[model samples]
Target: MGKDQDLLHAVKTEDLLTAQRLLQRPRPGKTKLLGTAKRVNVNFQDTDGLSPLHHAALSGNKELISLLLEAQATVDIKDQNGDSSTAL
Candidate 1:
């Protein structure tokens, strides 16, 4: 699956480990931590217009939500119903 699909799957299944892995990126030989993470498109919207942050919100996983936010996941990306993850 694509990174987007993987992110969504990780969110839906409440897989924090996988979600963290998705948000991370190796900088040549080093790695980017949450404080500096922004490699992946954590704001990417799915077919239904729900981003990974949106899914994380719905799932009520604080750790996942934190990770997404640190990765720069936009909180204002509206879904099909015109509601963002922050609304949850």
Candidate 2:
């Protein structure tokens, strides 16, 4: 429940394109409107203490894992149980 929560949702729902698009920041006519979605923080954790990278790893999405890594998602971030995405 935060500004960039959609980023987490996109990862959770397996919506790769939407996740990719949301990662893009809107520029001067070079991208689509993402509203607040454009300001998403790649490393932001949800209430469950799970970050997008965590979900991607849990879902076994290699493509999403690459995207998240490219976006600088912190791999060592722990979840509610102090588990990290080092599974990647």
lDDT by residue (1-88, candidate 2, tens digit) is: 6547888999999899988987875677575545543477999888889999999999999999999999888899998888999954
Residues 1-88 of candidate 1: C-alpha lDDT, one tens digit per residue? 7777888889989999998888776658676567654456788888899999899889898999999888888999999999999898
Candidate 2: C-alpha lDDT: 0.85
- Where model 1 places Cα greater than 4 Å from the true spot, the runs are 28-39
Q: What clash pairs does model 1 have?
A: none
Location of the lowest summed lDDT over 10 successive residues in candidate 1? 31-40
Q: Highest TM-score: give the candidate number.
A: 1
Give me the runs in candidate 2 sitting further than 4 Å from their true place: 1-3, 28-38
lDDT (Cα, 0-100) at 87 in candidate 1: 95
Q: Model 2: how far is 17 from its true place, Å?
A: 0.5
